[model samples]
Target chain A: MYRQKYLFLLPGLLVLVAIILFPLLFTIRVSFSSWDVYNPGLNWIGGENYGRLWEDARYWQALGRLTLLSVTTVLIQYVLGFALALMVWRDLAARRLFRVLFLIPMMTTPVVMSVLWRTIFHESLGPLNPILESLGIGAAPWLSSAGWAFAAVVMVEVWQWTPFMFLLLLAGLLSLPNEPYLAAKIDGAGPVRTFFSVTFPMLGAISVGAILIRLIEASKIMETVYVLTSGGPGTSTETSSYYIYIRGMRDFQIGYSAALSLTYLIIMIVALTVIAKLLVRALVKDAA
Target chain B: MLKITDLELLVGSVAHLAAINASFQPGTLTTILGRTGAGKTTLMRAIAGLIAPDRGQILLDGTGWTRLPPWKRPVAMVTQQFINYPHLNVRDNVAFPLVRAGVAKADAAARAEAALARVGLAAMVDRRPSALSGGQQQRVAIARALVKKAPVLLLDEPFVNLDYNLREAFRKDLVDLLAVETGTVVLYASTDPREALQMGDQIVLLADGRIVQSGSPRDVFANPASLTAASVVNDPPINPIPFHQNGVADFGALGQQAITLPSGAYTLGLRASDIRAGGPHQARVTLTEVTGSETLTHLSLNGLDLVMQEKSVVLRSPGDVVGVHLDLHKGLVFGADGQRAGV
Candidate 1:
């Protein structure tokens, strides 16, 4: 029976090995070798690509930008999402309709959303500039200036993904045990006090989980930047993934890009592990 | 006094509470007795100011409290589920209300400790609610309410979630705790008649969102005004048999002995304890359940099912013929409208 059960899992195991394990091992192998699309030959470089990545100023800048984008976007998204979720969770007329309307942005394709936002942020002929101009503020070169371009990319990322956080946090809010809230009310705690004392504490684990997921996804952000700015105006918004794409596909430095990708993977693993530990500690502390 | 006059509450389209009128005296523990969905919780919520009544006035000491918010009301409620702030320890949980009331931290902590000691949970002050058992969590909730020191305490079936042994102990503890709570009217809602009889100084019987009866517990149990009141106040439920009158002061049942009631169609209600075994009337024992100290014998007499509780350790088997006697003087007679006829 055990042997038959093992046989039943054979096809799934083969697929996993083919799709996940093989590519991972190949990437690790190629990181140490000098291989380019034009050369068509693999040279045993033995850590040369890794050393080159460590010395590259543009690679470090891209890494820094990736960190800035992930942290800023996740933070802004969490605040805005929590506020929206709280508003929609209230007992109001057409609340369900508002919830559904808020989730539409998240349902749209990321690339398509990026294109739409790019048009909206157009410096010369966009609705955003006209609105700002009408408000007596001058039109901003949203997609042209380096600072504005980065801010634009972050805004698009936040706009597209904040709804996902809203949905998760809304579910967390709705499923919270009702008794504690009632207790708070009877105890004469006002709305603000109840939120800080009871609601926020109960939402700890879910908030941490949402932030972790958004952080992981944000760290790999390339599509929005690629569509909106394309790391233009002197590589201001070049995230690590876009930087790797530039090296591998645009510059044909496949081995160097592979090395950079491995380093990115390691950093993500360490960061996620640290965050998971902190969340577990928080949960355990709450339990205690 | 907490008085509700012409209280009408509508939950969506259905009338949850209709024309409810009752006045609860201060320093009395009034148990709202009813079955599930009998509007006991709704009444409690209305009194707590958690929900508004459609067309009624709730007065606390002659001041209208119907429009007041829950936080402004001088009331605290303990729900069926044990609700404690999971992240806060027992002391903090108990002190939360006081802290929110703008009491100083030291004063709140002192009062919280005193309340915990009152609930016999002072030793577990540092433990979180998750670390405590269900009974202990409820105690923490009670302590929280005690710390609030509200003039009115609404407990909505707070002991329903505990085990039988814990429930018994908690019931005693709750009774003792409320004993010394001067000037605070406690409204305890429960479906169990035994709990009402044990804990209530006054029992308010509700059925179909209407107040069927209200009086002292013993008086309400002994003379339930209607069939609904009798059914709500009886543990094993009152055995109601269809009674047909042949003539004046002559009724069917009791082996042809006529009851002294007017000639009419009626239903006779008898409590389990009032139906004795071994008398003149004969009945066949269908089932016998011995509960250590007493035996509950289910008997079929004249094609009517009757439950009799006896103290003797008699092992009456199924199909055994037993003489059943009913104390007719203690029996209840209900007319067509399910109300007691001729008092």
Candidate 2:
């Protein structure tokens, strides 16, 4: 019976091996050698690519920017999305309206949203700039200045994705059993205490899910940055994905790019594992 | 320490469907007995401040509670579902109110443990509700109420799901628990008359959003105000034989014999337990069913179905015509207006 079950899963297993497993192994193998695009044969240079990656200041800067963007965006989006979901969850009259309105941003293409944001942030007579100027504040270059460009990308990313977290957290909120809230009320707990103690702890799984999804999206934040800033004024808005795009695809250093991609994959795996462990630990302790 | 006066609750649709008028004194256990859709649960919810009564006043120790939300009402309600938080352990679920009340964590835990111990769930304190039995979960819900130590304890079928023994034990424990708490007023709702008989100090019988009868349990049982109240308070129900204005209560089939009453278009109510086979009247035995300790004898007499209890007597069988007697002194009489005949 167990053998038959394995046989039943054989086709899916084969597809997974063909599409994912084989390619991952091939990429790891290729990343170690100096296999050029033209030659297409492995010429082993061993640890040279790894050593070069360690010494690259541009790579370090990209990693730093990626970390900052992912961390800040994840935190901000989690807070804002959770708050909006809680508000919507509490109010029956506005729940459907706000759900539709908030989810509208998530349904739109991220690239399209980024382009719209870019137009809105245009330096000279954009809607926001004129409004700012009319309001007696000097219009600052939103996407032209290095710091402002990074900030602009972060804002666009948050706006496009906060609704994703909102949907998940709202589902989590709705799925929670109503007893704790009633128990809290009977205990003389005001709304604030009920939210922090009863509501937040119960929403732990959804929060973890939201953060994981946001982290992955934030790490691969290429399309929005590519459209809005195009790695901007300097490499200020350049994420690891953008860096990989420039080095591997644009420069066509296939083997070197594959090596860099593998390194990024390892980092992603490590971070996600650590985060999952920490989250499970905290949740278990809280449950205890 | 709770009093509800002229409590009228109208739930938006109609003027009369949700109206409840009653005044309950403090520290008394009142059981609101009703069938499904009779608005007993609605009345309790209104008093607990879960639903606002359209026209009434809820007072706690002479303080106005008309506008208070459930959180501000100083009342705790255990719903029929035994809705304890599944994510929380028994201790935390019990201690939930104290934690919310800004008590120190240690103090709250202590009180919660004591409450759990009171409900006989101390050994299962750290277990989640899913891990517990049905009776244990109900105990946890009661522990939540006890730990809250709220002045008014409202229970909507809290013991509905327990087995017979557990229900009996829990009912006794609940009575004792309520007795020890001086300021606590327990308002329990049950469809079962047996539960109301055992636990209620004051019994309010409801039907179609109106209180048909509200009095002490013994008074309600001994002299039910209406045929409906009588039926609701007994197992096989008080057999109501319809009669007419000639001072004759007609029980129509077995012989269509006229049972002369005191006066008017009155009905005679004979409880199944009060019906005996020894006296002068005769009834054809229609069926006899033995339910362990008691035998339920169904009979056809005076054109009505009369159910009576006999203690395993081997005197009758199906279709055996036998002479039976109803103890009229213990019978309740209801007049044409549906009120108790004497009242």
Candidate 3:
């Protein structure tokens, strides 16, 4: 009877295989083929695409650019999210109203928000440059220069997803026990000391969890780039996902794109694992 | 010395604590005895500067402490729950206050080690609080509170969460540790009357956010000012029987006592220990609880509920009929307004 009980899990297992397992297996097989727009058929060409990806300068550049963009944006979001969470977590004049207002950005769709941000970042006609000019800070370029386009992409990503970090951190702050804070207060710890000694240490596990979740979401950073910059200003903001999209959809190199996808999945898995370990070590003191 | 005058705290529209006036002497542990919501914690928090009273003056050593924040006050407190820094080791947990107060690092470590040794936790200084048992974690909290050596120390039911055996052991350890601090005016809050009677040098009985009685334990036990005071000072709680007969205190069906008193509505306070089994009056057992080696049985004679205490375990189920006898000569008499009249 116990042996037959495994059949009870068959439905969920079938759904997993249908949606996830089959695509993965098919992609692994297709990665070794020589399928393209011109050829239009799968022909065995083992390791050729992998060898080309290894020597592809543009692919390497996109990977590096993806790393820099994600790490910078995630760190900025973490800091700003923590600050906003602390602000609304405690006593405020209009706490409920502010909390709902803070959630507005995250509630909107990211691709839609990115499109709105594109209009906002328009060089002369947009409100941002005009305000900067009024404030005595002249606007040189937004989407017209390489560095400015990169910064514009980061700005949009930060604006769209920072509320996610804020929500998680706020939930974490709400769940923390109030007793440790009382102990800190009685021990004569000022605001800074209490934060370092009690609040930050208590928030360690949740902080790491939130950061890793954001990193995973951030590493796949192509939607905003697609809507806003579209790998603009000569490939300055072209991340790994957009490079793959260009190869598979735009250039129609299905075989090579499949190879890139599998390689990118493996790289993300290793990189995220490494980052999680480092975060756990750095944030949680007693875990060591 | 610490003194509070006319302290009033309002939560919503309810008065959590009102018209409070109390004084604590140095080298004495004043146990604030009350029920769970009797404002014992609010009073302690006001003294520690964790809570603000709407109208009050807290004078410490002839200087006002009302305006100072908790971080500025020279006070240390251990709450009912076990609160220790999970990220720090046991020694660092104890040393946190000292380090925060700007003591030398080595001096703070030494004092923390000494406090840990005093609490019988010398062998576990390097372990995190999460690695210890609940009792050990509370001990770390206690050691941390002790290492500060503040002039005023407030412990709000510090051992209320521990198991029975651990609570007893930690209580003894805490008393021993506190005995060494001669200058600290300790305010210990508890709902257990036995603990309040045993550990307090002076007892403050609170009811409905007011101090019903405050005196030495022996004095309060010998002469409870009111029915509320009598209830707070009793372990199993005192039973108040209505009596309104001339020259006799009628206890309705259970028995009556011929006493020299005027005819008026009064309450007769009877201790649980004075009521015994196997007597002329029969009562149905309503509840039975076996705690340690003693038994506390609740019996209802007619409509009056009376608790009987026995030295040894007596297993009696609910609805079981049993005979009980009350010692009327040892009872106390309270007036119609609940104030103790006389014996």
Find the candidate with the highest lDDT and give its number: 3
TM-score of each: 0.85, 0.90, 0.86
lDDT for each residue of candidate 2 in A1-288, tens digit (9 for 90 to 100):
666777888899999999999999998888888776675677787878788888878887998999999999888999999989988987569679988999888899888888899999999847988998889997988998999999898898889899999999999998988877766766677788778777887887778878988898788889998999999878888988899889888877777878889999999999988987787667543434
The per-residue C-alpha lDDT of model 1 at residue A221 equals 93
Clashing pairs in 2: B251-B302, B251-B303, B252-B302, B252-B303, B253-B302, B253-B303
lDDT of 3 by residue, A1-288 (tens): 879999989999999999999999998888999789999777889999999999999998999999999999999999999999999999988987888898898889878898888888999778899989999998859998999999999988888788999999999999988877888999999888998888888889999999999999999988899989999878988999999999999999999999999999999999999999999998978567
lDDT of 1 by residue, A128-217 (tens): 999999999989999999999999998999999999899999999998887788888888877888888888788888898898999999
Poorest lDDT segment (10 consecutive residues) of candidate 2 chain B: B251-260
| Candidate 1 chain B minimal-lDDT segment of 10 residues | B248-257
Per-candidate count of clashing residue pairs (backbone under 3 Å): 0, 6, 0
Q: Report the candidate with higher lDDT, 2 versus 3.
A: 3
Instruction: DockQ each candidate and list the results.
Output: 0.59, 0.56, 0.63
- Residue pairs with backbone atoms closer than 3 Å in model 3 (clashes): none
B273, model 2: CA deviation in Å? 1.5
The residue-by-residue lDDT of candidate 2 on B42-113, one tens digit each, is 877777776777887878778988888778878888877777876678898888888877889899999999
Cα TM-score of candidate 2 = 0.90
DockQ-derived CAPRI band for the predicted complex in model 1: medium
Error of 3 at A102 (Å): 2.8
